[model samples]
Target: MTALPQERRVVTAIPGPKSQELQARRTAAVASGVGSVLPVFTTRAGGGIIEDVDGNRLIDFGSGIAVTSVGSSAEAVVRRASAQLQDFTHTCFMVTPYEGYVEVCELLAELTPGDHAKKSALFNSGAEAVENAVKIARAYTKRQAVVVFDHGYHGRTNLTMGMTAKNMPYKNGFGPFAPEIYRVPVAYGYRWPTGPDNAGAEASAQAIDMINKQVGAENVAAIIIEPVLGEGGFIEPAKGFLPAIAQFAKDNGIVFVADEIQSGFCRTGQWFASEDEGIVPDLITTAKGIAGGLPLAAVTGRAEIMDAPHSGGLGGTYGGNPVACAAALGAIETMKELDLNAKAKRIEEVMKARLSSMQEKFDIIGDIRGRGAMIAIELVQSGTKDPNPAATAALAKACHAEGVLVLTCGTYGNVLRFLPPLVIGEDLLTEGLDILEQAFAGV
Candidate 1:
């Protein structure tokens, strides 16, 4: 794969003159609702750096919100996608069946958590996959209610907005969400009422009790969760938590859906985070890293559950676009060839060590958690557990100013998440962490 310079070179102020000029035009043309973290327009990006309009090369830690796990311009992804584009960009899979779509489904069936008879349907985005998973679950179970967890983030769609727990940016002023959705407590070990050791059992018991007393499991179609919560902070649910919930879903006939959008591909050490707890979900929603940079998502699950929907029940106009599917195949190939799973694990080892040391010095860092490359630090008050969103914001701003891309997310916005590309070299990773350390020091 062709590589970008594995260096952090800031030739100008963060949003340099050229970027500032573009920003002014963007301000007038783009809708106010659309938000951007770093406003400098990216002219080229690959490996671990993104070169902006003004030639500033920034270290990439966000990986385009975990969409570039195989790297932004993976050779396989680019080659296959480009070849497909040359042949035919879009015939619309719905209109004309394509080998690429079928091939991607075959791969997903083999890759997702379960070994049982499986099937898949592709979509344009993670939100679309999630929505379809819900639809399939309800259809299969002949039930209406869907259950999610606190500190969960599904999507911006009306249905997923109701599934998402946060309110401000995602759900503010946008109401009348889909009904029959219930929220339960997640096993957030760091913030759990009980101690971390007891968090799994406590949270599972509470969620089961709530489902029975309030939502009635018999009436529920699915229980969706992120194995390692994303955007809601990279909160890896306590060890036994996921298995307990999966068993509960099995016993109650609730379609257990793992929303692996942010945690899937090789972003986590495992191909799918659900595998970490050995909890084979009945349905798994995936996207982000699935197709390199191209938009693609899938709902892979038990064949019986997937076939529950009518023939015309699931599909989108542009679902599994040929080029995107080709990109997905190539990305998967690249992942296997390069063993990105091991790469993610190594990243975790490197980051955990560095971040743990940082945590020792910075008491504001309340917790460090996550698996593989999808790691994060929860910022809090110096001596208290109270979230310090201000500190988090300042730290991220500092990173941006110094030519590094870091993302902040959480219900309280007190999280700084690091999702570097799995292909990022150790040197770049170390450099980015150095920039993070400097940002923390300044903040």
Candidate 2:
């Protein structure tokens, strides 16, 4: 067996020699608006290992924020994308459609949760998928209002920003946002105003009441939610919450949308997180892991709802570019052949065991929650549930210093989320967990 490297060897500290040089160049050449997770510039990535410019190989736990579920540079994904590039890159689907695009749509219709007749539209990014979902809802319902939940992140676009709940970086100065968008409380169990063990049904009832009272249900076109909130921390909505919301939407003639951008494609042990709850959404938005690492996203929904938008209103210049479609096809094949759903469940078992043990040893670990491979550990004050943002930041910094790449999330920025690629070796996963435990001890 080829031994995977463990115990981070810091050759030249975190950034090292080459990364520092590249960082300066990146500062000069690249747009400052785009943010980077780690300071080290990556040269290559495979499985769960990312090799930096300084020749430092680190375990990647963030998985490009849950994008590369099949792992970066999977053989099939690379081979298929390379072959497609040689054939042709673009000829927009609208201008002249290709078999690759149609094939991806067929796969999506078959894969996404729901047995209803489905239709799909492709887009260039997660935000684009989200934006189009909204347009489709509006066209189908002929309603002006859209309802989003608190701590929910839709996208960076102006309309999505208004639909999103976070205020700082996503919505700070960029609005005057789109009108008729509203926010209600999410079923976040932790930091829940009422109590810790509140039933999901009760939470959903309360939220539904708010919608009915504040924004009449008849006026609402859709309710968009993440089955498991991504950037707002990996908080899975309480059990029964999703089903209840779906029921309310159905009763009120509102479109129920599940934003599975971060939680889809076996990332959550199931094909889609919505499957866990048996909640069939009227629409599902997917991206991230959909096309391996290529820029692609999609909105798959009930045939009636998707068809509501006029033919000419729903595409982009490169929405279903052949290269991206090929990558997506390969990704789907990889997910099946590798049994990534089983791998995700296996990952969750290991994560729960390791992180639960860490919680017993570390007082800062307030809560450990998530399903399948999508897990998070929220840091808090020693004896209270107060968010310990400083300690969380310090722990992440320590992990990075030790050559492990992890990420922080949560509305208060006190949660460390683990989203390692499902293809990662058990030894590497354990080693990364060990690093996190040591970092917590040091903090």
Predicted structure with the largest TM-score when compared to the true one: 1
TM-score of candidate 2 versus the correct structure, residues matched by position:
0.97
Give me the displacement of residue 291 in model 1, in angstroms. Answer: 0.2
Put down candidate 2 lDDT per residue, 1-443, tens digits, no spaces. 11334334467688898999998999999999788878898877878788888878888898898888888888888889999999998989899889998999999999988788999999999999999999999999999789999889989999999988878768888989999998877788877777656848668988899999999999999999999998898888888888999999999999999999999999999999999989899999999999889999999999999999987989999998899999999899999999999999999999999999998988889999998889999999999999999998998899998888999998888999999988988988998998998998889
Task: Give Cα-based local distance difference scores for all models.
Answer: 0.93, 0.89
Which number leads on lDDT? Answer: 1
Clashes of each: 0, 0
List where candidate 2 sits over 4 angstroms from the true fold. 1-9
Report the error of model 2 at residue 225, Å.
0.3
